[model samples]
Target: MSTHVEGSTDLKYVSDEAFIDTGVRKVVSKGNWQQQYMSLRSFPEGDRNCYKIGVTTGTKYLIRASFFYGNYDGEGMPPTFDLYLGASLWDSVKTSSSSDFTIDPEIIHVPQKNHIHICLVKTSHGIPFISAIELRPLDNSTYQAQTGSLALLDRLDTGVSTWTR
Candidate 1:
């Protein structure tokens, strides 16, 4: 059986209430969005906070993390933080401004164990927050990384004009 954690059927996102105990949930003061992005879990206390997700070992998966500041904290200044996959540094998440829509970071990785920890580390720029996280299993043969995991640099869609999730 697959060891991955299941999300809500309608939204396909695991509830933070069930998976994480830290951070207070805050709703966006502006913009109309789906239920997932409308609210976020903000970590204001800890230096590092993580969400542990179960996945099958040796399976190739596309893990995506989304951040939307929306000035949820009432502070106009957006925060800059670091994202880590376990002990390895994934990327530094920077928000240009509080009005910025969303920043989505994606990585393709094969776990060495049965679970993976997605951690957000505070960099003192602002409070760390996350809107959504998704894990989708992929075929092991595809996206063959020569040495380490692959991080998405850019994604372009030709035809679509309007914003999409």
Candidate 2:
């Protein structure tokens, strides 16, 4: 998990919502977690970490959350991590584990009809100060642009026409 920000090497620092110093001690819910960037600590502004995140069950493709730190070893401050892989509200899923998953992007396919969830159970198993996370999908080379941006792109401009072609 490469850092989107230069200094913040932890993958957990992506949403700015994943905070440790924001007076908020935790972040979780059955489905909805903290979406507000300014409210959380530890996390920084920008979603460069999510850039490497893709969704799918191991049947289709593995999820490689390539973050900076590991929730292994009893060293993390909180001792927990979580990952939500779906793009919509309906596709949300989760995983709570004691060990950290690998980040090697591969071609091994699996069944991922719904959303993928990779939660690093944040209280007992382990803890890590993440800086980035990378998930695995069949193809995510061009998904960085949010679908809602299609409308904005239609009316947007760069003062140049050569690139559009």
Candidate 3:
């Protein structure tokens, strides 16, 4: 079953031992961005922040995290940070334009354990925040290559043809 965990909503999957900030905002413009979001309870305090979500073991899922910096702090400055899946690095949440909503997607990943950890690490620039977290179950055929011990392949071309000399 697919799960859409709104950052504003509380759940049993989230670790209670730790603290995370949750609040709602009045979004002037509406379309893709959600009006409410959950942010890190504290900023630049911990070395790493994690969200432990329970799931069925051996299940393949596509996880996505979204962020909308609506000036929750009223400072008009959005923070940039790093996001993590388990012990591996997933992606960096860079809030370039506070008005633009940012979404990060992770391909098929089969968790051997019953739970997966989603983490946010504070960057030198600003704090970390999350607007929402979504998970969707994927069929075996979705990403067969990732079901095994293999990892995603990233290719980069630095040739003059592809890059500036």
Winner by TM-score: 1
What TM-scores do the predictions have?
A: 0.85, 0.27, 0.65
- How badly does each model clash, as a count of residue pairs? 0, 23, 1
Across residues 53-161, which tens digit of lDDT does each residue of candidate 1 receive? 8889999999989998888888888899999999899999997554646899999999999999999999969888999888889989999988779999999868966
**Descending-TM-score candidate ranking:** 1, 3, 2
TM-score of 2: 0.27
Q: What lDDT tens digits, residue by residue, belong to model 2 across residues 23-55? A: 222332223222321121222232212222333
Position 65, candidate 3: lDDT: 72
Model 1 compared with the native: what TM-score? 0.85
Question: Candidate 1 vs candidate 3: which has greater lDDT?
Answer: 1
Error of 1 at 143 (Å): 0.3
Candidate topping lDDT: 1
- Report the CA-based lDDT of candidate 1 relative to the real structure: 0.85
Q: Ten consecutive residues with minimal summed lDDT in candidate 3?
A: 19-28
Error of 3 at 95 (Å): 0.9
Candidate order by lDDT, decreasing, is 1, 3, 2
